[model samples]
Target: MMSDVFLRIENLRKEFGATPVVNGLDLDIKQGEFVSLLGASGCGKTTTLQMIAGFEKPTSGRIWLNGKDITDVPPSKREIGIVFQNYALFPHMTVEENILFGLVLRKVDKAAQRKRLSELLDLVHLVGLEARYPRELSGGQQQRVAIARALAIKPNVLLLDEPFSNLDARLRADMQNEVKRLQIETGITTILVTHDQAEAMALSDRLAIMHKGVALQVDTPQATYDHPASRYVGNFLGNINILQADLRDVGSHVSFSANGKSLQVLNDQRLSPERCCISIRPERVRIQPQPTDCEVLLGATVTSKNYNGNSWDIGTETELGSVNINIPHHGAPTPDRGQSIVVGWNLNDMRLVHVD
Candidate 1:
């Protein structure tokens, strides 16, 4: 059976005054899929979400939900649920009231409303807290109530805008897992707008990394981190060590010459014989006290070491440039500062990116 597309956005453009926020964007989201629009501030992720929710009108383009054109639909008529960062729960309303507000407004019967309220409360793990007001709940609990309220109408699409941004680090991680769990249980199409890369990676089946109102890359979180499409995407996704090297005159087996050392390119098709940038993750780099018989080696001086509980972040000043390396702590002796070390990486580990 072919799974149908749940949402389709074509040439979606949004503008604020004279500036374009979402510039000619196109996207397709599959049913029961969790897609996140990730970018920094002013990247128009929130604008795209708002347009889908009918909170903002697009300057141009079309939005289709299950083959129905909803470009001109009002917010209340869209049948889309939205959860905001601040929870947006009414301060004076109890949790049950908040969850039942939409049903009540729609003139649902008292019996049916009560049944749906119980199910929603239990779904969000707030069954016993229905009588509690927003003031009586913690940040995470309040957010759960907000989620329950959004799901009360049984929306076909759920939109979350920085849903866990208000929680602390630990609570944020916990909620990420909770949201993923609930998404699996409901099988509703979900779109999350977030500026945090970790949050996007944790929850998104596929993520769109936006930049300046354009999507630079749309792929799975692991793919985006492992094989970024551009240098900008590589830098934004995670910690990368970029080295400048001349690739001119290099043959099928391209070699990167830097710091008086040469590194062979295993995948020659990915490199060009011109100005190029080599990006490697910190975890891909291996540091040793002495150079091995490897074809490529670089000397670096350990500048600082930071212990991050599970791993150590080692900063080094290499002849090529300053680089950061992450090493897992498994009872291995920590390298001291001022120690000279040789850092090695396989050719396959390096991603050759064109530098313009």
Candidate 2:
């Protein structure tokens, strides 16, 4: 149950040599919430993570956790566990010793230390390999060791910094599952920093899409994908076809026209620009040889088609505009190149995105 504000960032800012990295960033994370800071390289996601980890000082702003301010807290006293991108494990120490390092520093009793060690080994599925050195372990195994080490002390919150970037495709998926399971079982509020959109959507309860040190949009992965607040966020999240259009008011509704082809949708009221753009996702467009007499979103000729396992990515030049259509191959007959097709979509799926 994600309830109450567990962590809050207030007007955070950071700079280096007069260049701003993070500016006026404010975010609230609920208890047990898994949030990811997502963006491209140089977007300040890593810098934000460092500030939260107490490794970098903010030029201005404060960070609150539980109920107290921790902006000035030392990393050692923050009780935050982090799994670095490279899975930083000691070269010489065995997995057991590495995991026990934190407990040893705290001087926990021997019996308690042994009990926790056994539990962690079991938790990360490394029960039999606790004696092996990091060099002897595979990348996935080393990652598991790093996770075990981070969780050995039962931290209040966990931070993951592109932890799966070094793994292969299959291994990365496996590790993502492992991390999700660990978070669920341990109930540790988690934060992730990643440039991979799929990774962020897969691992986060909600993701904040940041750019140039600021969060442009923060919402659940699906909601944000479906209703991106801006064109940049929409295109960044997935493939979006931006069609130039003129907007005209129609009572409580709005009509968008592209090259004289028009469709009306309930006015979301946030849009006011007389001339704006419309964003349509490929999945939203249905490509059929003949759509019923009701309404066709657009008419187009297929220029190219590629079968991608579960879907056919068809590129088309339409009367409305050029757009890509992703047709799912669930028994639907494939459309050949040069075939004439009509596209249809629900009005509700066409969200009004502000141009940035």
Candidate 3:
């Protein structure tokens, strides 16, 4: 069964003069779902967010929020909350006062406002620091204040625009977990825009990969990573090994041949033999002392090795090409540079994709 959509963007197109920023983009966000618009800079992720927030009007398209058209609605009347990258908290206002500003503008009573303020403070875990101003708070604390203020309005939809870009690596991880927890607790329909692939994958229920003003692919994070729609998405998500090979249709499988070496791979789908590429993740490749107990094995010499705490990122030169692998540092003896070894992988790990 499909989830009920709370927000829909239909044929959304935004242009500044002649250059199109968002081109015919369509997205349906289910209620209580967390979706992230992910891409590099100038990919139209920010433009899409701004159009949804009513900060920038779309050149041609329609936006529906909870069954009502809001394409031309003013930002103040949209009932949507936004947390900017800068945390955008009022400099002069205290934490509590900043959170209460929206409520006060709507003429909410003082007693009710105080009660909500207490709840928000507890929700964001900033109870004792309510009296402190934004200038006095740390970066993480200021972000929490922004979240509290956004949630205080009880918005129908929440938008986060690179909300963690300002924090350091450690704080960014902490805030990612915090944001995921809060989204589950509140069940607010949230859309986040960010260029960080790991951060988007960590927090989003579904991720839309944008490129050159178009959404290239949209799916679960693992699905997009494992089965990318195009070469660009495959390269963007993580480290992958690409092979230029000539594919031949053998009885029940396909044979990928390159540099006088042939690798037998199972045929999962019909693929064009003329122009195709094989992609495999580094972690899927196994290294052994010699050629033993493997379907496809290649003799290689270790070129480089980098220890990353628990795993070793190894680079090897083989008959096919230079391939990289990530392996457990403790299980096997660490292969040193200038050492000979055999590399093998299961046929299912290799994917036949179009040549980009």
Candidate 4:
């Protein structure tokens, strides 16, 4: 019988000498879901991918593919497709040869190989570049060949490890869109490993945010960005200002007081009387000439400003600490350096986090 889950990673663990790279990692990928494993270097994202690919044997845990245990399977016998960051295309071989190399090795029928090669060339939008060598093609084209080569085997699961990292910025964006379109068209269950939060947000149906060999949050991009479970995730995903606050005794609603300013709390479950960390995203902050009554207000001095076409990043040095605010470029109030301004946010905009 066909399984409901396409891939299931249970208690996956990996260690390198004294350091544990993947510590008890568990993930469930449904069929056709595009999941991205996002983390910084040495955070075990690549190691986890390697383990799943059977390139690295896990120190422990079982990996199930289509409900069959494949933790002990060798890379060659795993029947999975993988595209690396470096393209890994043979410089001596032409695009057609490189793509056909896999099928050739497997001794696929000559006619079948020719058909698959033609289909892949068309799928990757390189229908007539069969004769062009890897050196002759652009970086984006080479990457496309690499992807096409991986998909030639028609593997059940596709793994991409920083696939567009080598491309230029513009090319990288184009490749991201192309990969998303290809994945949707092919309905491949793909797992992409990337440190780029924007890339993960753009491509993934759900993203697994890793930190120091642990999965911090695995959810939709919007949910992970808006409702980070910890300070680490909150800081890693985007620009967030964390403030130290003390919960104040309020009658019905809980309030947090920080640097002589009080902010009401909408949710009481996560709030505590002890000191806590309040996380506010840069976009949630509002800069004003004067403090408002219902808003959590703090006096801040403008430190720096950056204009990035669509948005302006305004840095402010407040009594609590330095904080960054992102304002839309169209009608944003310009705050001069050394000028005092009021930074305010609503209670619902703030997230109370445990001080860790």
Candidate 5:
């Protein structure tokens, strides 16, 4: 599908009063690709979405949609559907009226409009609530109405700006499932802008990690979490334990040593052997009372242990360094504080990460 580039942003840049919000960002989205622009607040994710929606002008760049440049296209002509964070439904309008508003503006034939309205209501599971005003609906129902309104015109691409932020935790999760279902059924090229890591990972086929007005890395959600290109991206996605060590190249392999403990790593010719920092996920580490067969094993004493619902987060002090291990809490006895334990992990779990 690499040949089917449906949306492209070339060197996109936006500046307000000399402060650049988005700078030199280039991204290619395949047809039917679901991509999320992810980052913290003020990281320019929303600004980037605004530019793509043609609501904000880029200071310098080009946006291509379906093989044509749309940088200067008006929002009305772009055929893009947007679902805002606040679910911007008309207060006085009924759900049916809100959904039909777009079709009415496009002057769709009455018969066709009725058919689409019926289908959308069913698509979003709002069959019997069509006559209810926005005030009469729950937050989730209101969100469904917003989505139905956006999709009524059959847009080429869909943009969602933190669409679940206003809902409660359970409702937010339900809405996420609904949006994913809609995207799969409609096959619309979708772009979601969100600051929530879990939401972005759950909904996106590809995630773009943005920081300081630029995208640090764009990859699948799992790949991004497993092999983050930088420390910031790694820590942002999940819990990561970073170790500083001296790197030694051993012919076709590399060894990282710190405080008399060493771990062998696969030789990646792409990376220089002199790198000093490597990272591993806390969950990748295993804790046992006795040493097991592993690429790296260290004896440590538990300094603290906290029991989460599904896992025990144990902090320990070892010869290698201060290490944290997350073990499942499935009826197994957890190690007590000051108790000796062994920590082990595979070499492949440790990834070379940017020190910064």
Candidate 6:
């Protein structure tokens, strides 16, 4: 069965003259789902967000909201709320006034406006501080005010454009959690745009990993991270070890030669690429003092090791090339500098990606 999509973007193409910003983008967002557009800087994620918010018109595309075409709808009449990178709260207005700005613009009655204001103040946990100005509130408080203002209109969709970028790390985490909580309570379909991999992974129901002007993959965070559609998507999400290998396609698995040693990878998808490379996650590589019967072992020398709180980030020099691995520092011994160790990984730990 298919989910009832709330927002549908089909063939969404946007260009600045000859340079394409979003090239033929297609995404279906389910009702009340939190979807995120995640990519690096200049990857067209922000521009896509702007298009959806009606701040920028697509050169060609169709946007459907609840089965109605909204491609040419003006920003104000789109019934979509947008919170910008800068909260854009009126500096002179108090929290109460700021949160009520949308209501006032729409000429909502005073009684209903007061009721909504009180609900929002309680929802964002700014009850007693409603009289305070933006300057007097903390960064977190100001962000809550912005969110409340956007929600004031009770729009059909909420667009968050890097809303937490200006906060400190701790505050950012706090705000992410707060926003997620608010979304759950209100059950409002939301879209977040951010370059932070962890933020997208933690918050989104699904992620659209965009490249230059296209989404390379769109799937659940765990699925996309573990099983990336391409090398670009894999590298964009986090750290990956790309290595050269001589491959031979087997029936159910593919055999490869690395460092003049034979290794095999599972061919679940039956991928037959003309040019391919091996990708292994650093966290999956294990430093074994002795080789196990079921593992493929490589002789490596520990060139550097650094303690990064929870794990020991180790770099090794292997015959194939340099390989990096993470060893959990759970009160266990780790290899020191200039120490020879055997790094091993099972067949399931390897991935085959087309050469980029």
Tens-digit lDDT track for model 2 on 289-312? 555633545678889999999888
- Itemize residue pairs with steric clashes in candidate 1: none
Clashing pairs in 6: none
Between which residue pairs do clashes occur in model 4? none
Per-residue CA lDDT of candidate 1, range 4-109, in tens?
7789988999988999999989888998999999998999999999999999999999999988899999999989999998888999999999999999999999
TM-score of each: 0.93, 0.94, 0.93, 0.93, 0.95, 0.96
| Local accuracy of candidate 3 as per-residue lDDT tens digits, 78-109 | 99999999989999999999999899998999
Q: How close to the true structure is residue 326 of candidate 5, measured as C-alpha lDDT?
A: 86
What is the clash tally of candidate 1? 0
- In angstroms, the error of model 5 at 12 is 0.7
Best by TM-score: 6
TM-score of 4: 0.93
Error of 2 at 352 (Å): 0.5
lDDT per residue, candidate 4, 22-73, as tens digits? 9999888999999999999999999999999998999999999988899998
Off by over 4 Å in 6: 1-3, 258-261, 291-294
Off by over 4 Å in 3: 1-3, 249-254, 258-271
Which regions in candidate 5 have their CA more than 4 angstroms from the true location? 249-253, 258-262, 267-269, 273-276
- Our tally of clashes for model 6 stands at 0
RMSD to the hidden true structure, all candidates: 2.4, 2.2, 2.3, 2.4, 1.9, 1.7
The true-versus-predicted C-alpha distance at residue 310 of model 4, in Å, is 2.3
In model 1, where do residues sit more than 4 Å from their true spots? 1-3, 249-253, 258-262, 266-276, 291-295, 354-356
The lDDT for every candidate, in the order shown, is 0.86, 0.87, 0.88, 0.87, 0.89, 0.89
